[model samples]
Target: MNEQIHEKLKEIKQSFRLMMNGVASHSMREKWVAYKINWGVPIPDLQKMAAEYGKDYELAIELWKEEIRECQVLATLIMPAEKMDEDLVEVWMERLRTQEMAEMLAFNLLQHLDFAPALAYKWIASDRDMYQLCGYQLLARLFARGMEPNERGINEFLDQAHTTLEGNNLPLKHAAYNCVLSFCELGDEFDVIAQKALADLNIL
Candidate 1:
């Protein structure tokens, strides 16, 4: 049954891949999809697949990220109804240890409200460079979604965000921008927090 599910998913992946044929890599595919397709369309396909599999979110997550951006959109859509349990979240987090794919997975996992902050926090502290970025990205997504961001946690994340900027890649900066963007949208409620974030970080 699982094999059947995977086969069906592969067929879809291949079909989409063909639609973007000559896209040599995931990044190219992302750019093409971002420019050409409406993200909203992928959800119905994802939801249909999710329901067909009886809420096997883990499988859906795995299949979704097999192609990165398309997978990320699908994973985000899959989150509202069927959230993965803690154990499966851990499995997903473990996959984030590999820098090559972790960023996309971490981004997707944060969309699912069931994920524990500890999972994201742990990866933020990890020695692996990109996983650290993934960690920050997850936290940013959570903060952006208004899921977490209590004082102490937000303060801790602020400190990490500062440290992150001192590191490399655009991921950390993007994460901070996303968090502040969310904070700004919350109006005066997050003014003090946003002020603290600006004060503590060199982020532009």
Candidate 2:
């Protein structure tokens, strides 16, 4: 089973390399490659592949390490988001541990699943660059997805966002601004909470 997964990953890597010749490095070709490959594929394909291997996460983790950047990105799509083990997710998270990417993933996952607040809170308070963005991204996605924002959660995230803005770090500031903008699209229920949060932060 490991051999089969390894071979399959090799084929994917070869195909990805062939596809990359036309992709400009200045653009986000890796993400595009991952999106194209995973889109429209049945989730069962991943399940079947994992099942054949006895659902060995160690094998999956090893396979993720074998690939280059785009391959790792593509590998994440094969793991069922809901069934992802805590340890395996942590392992994969470490592999893609950029602040922006971490934040981006928190937002992306919220679109498909409920907020794992404990997992998210670690990133929210992280002093690292991308990890902090992960927190704001989670908050923005919660509002953007219209998922009944918890008042306490909103207040907590706003506190973090305000801190981010005060840092004078351009990347964090931009992420915060985008998060605020995304939050604005929510109607009155969230608006009322956001208005109060912002006032408390003196962002109003």
Candidate 3:
């Protein structure tokens, strides 16, 4: 890393240390978060920090490589969407280790990307749980924003969501459920379609 990024890393880690919560960190561990270093910094605090740091692609990439939960979350918040090309996104996806990271990236970063729809669709088709969770979460954000997918997209989404909801992964099911709910929010037509699609799963 360059001197400037190294200095910034030191500063960010120091800030994370100052805001750390043992209780939150313990809870996350109990839930199997598995981050090598988790400061237990809350999302609101991370957002404040991101605003202070502003967007710097290099800094975000370095932060993400830290293996610290707070830094990764901060990376998602402060990353420049335009600079996060497909290859970079795949690299990050390969590094994803937990559902928390998936949700954090989906909520704070991927949702804003111009190619998020295609990305979400691609991930949902993956057999990996984390990928599916991220996909569903990203789709939920898009749905909440009232974005409409074309017929093929809707079909693909419904198939993946139904498969996920029917599976045993609670996190993926919940994420898929949220997507369905937000998809319903698009309109009554979407509502009917989603309801019919996942009715057997007992979620609308």
* Clash number for each model: 1, 3, 0
TM-scores for all candidates?
0.62, 0.70, 0.96
Q: Determine which window of 10 residues in candidate 1 has minimal summed lDDT.
A: 32-41
List ranges where model 1 is wrong by over 4 Å: 1-3, 23-83, 96-109, 200-204
Clashes of 2: 3
Q: If ranked by lDDT, best first, what sequence of candidates would result?
A: 3, 2, 1
For model 1, how does the per-residue alpha-carbon lDDT over 1-204 read when each residue is reduced to its tens digit?
Answer: 377667866675665554443433445445443323322324345556546545445556665445344454455445433456766655555544333244445554455555547767776677766556667667666766666467776677666666766566665566656655665565566766666667746443
Residue 203, candidate 3: alpha-carbon lDDT:
60
Q: For candidate 3, lDDT tens digit of each residue in 60-103?
A: 99999888999899999889999999999999998899999999
Off by over 4 Å in 3: none
Best candidate, lDDT: 3
Q: What is the TM-score of candidate 1?
A: 0.62
Q: Determine the backbone clash count of candidate 3.
A: 0
Model 2: CA > 4 A from native: 21-23, 27-63, 97-100, 107-115, 199-204
